[model samples]
Target: MKYSREELEEAKRQIDSTLHKLRETIKTFEAKEEKARYKSQITLAKRRVKAFEIANYFIEEAMEK
Candidate 1:
């Protein structure tokens, strides 16, 4: 599938927003002592970070094309 520059830019923006939200959630979970909650938040944060990294890689690839 082919993506326009605008579409790629929008995807990058959404990923960035998701990353920011995950970071905030992690910070909030850090203040609590619920092990399950903390663990879940950390897992989500890691996933979000990974997603953002992947999105960035795609953006770079798109730019190079």
Candidate 2:
């Protein structure tokens, strides 16, 4: 997918914010169910962050060409 620099920056910011929230939530919870939910959220957030990073790299490469 094609992404502009502005969009990539926005995505990066949003992803970072989401990851932060997920990590904090994970840290706050101690119950099994709550911890499971937070763990899943954290895993999902990490995957999203990585995906966006790859997409940003593609955008960078496209910018160079």
Candidate 3:
């Protein structure tokens, strides 16, 4: 399947937003002694990183097209 340039741009924006939120959550967790929340935040951060990679890939593909 092929994505339009606009679609790719939107995906990148969404990924960026998600990553920013995850980072903020991690910072908040760091200020507390909630082990479960901290662990969940780490997981969320990892997922955001993966989403970023996917967004980057789509953006590159769009550029090539």
Per-model clash counts, in order, read 0, 0, 0
In candidate 3, the residue pairs with backbone N, CA or C atoms under 3 Å apart (3 or more residues apart, or in different chains) clash, namely none
Model 3 agreement with the true structure over 12-61: per-residue lDDT tens digits: 78877877877777677777877675787677776877777777786877
TM-score-sorted candidate list, best first: 1, 3, 2
User: How high is the lDDT of residue 39 in model 2?
Assistant: 71
TM-score of each: 0.74, 0.50, 0.64
Q: Which candidate is the best by TM-score?
A: 1
Report how far off residue 22 is in candidate 2 (Å). 0.2
**Cand. 3 TM to true fold:** 0.64
lDDT (10s digit) by residue, model 1, range 1-65: 89888988888788788878877877777777775757866887878788788878988798679
Q: Which stretches of candidate 2 lie over 4 Å from their true place?
A: 31-65
Q: Cα lDDT for residue 37, model 3?
A: 56
Model-by-model lDDT, in order? 0.81, 0.64, 0.75
Q: Candidate 1, clashing residue pairs?
A: none
Model 2 deviation from the true structure expressed as Cα RMSD, one decimal place: 4.4
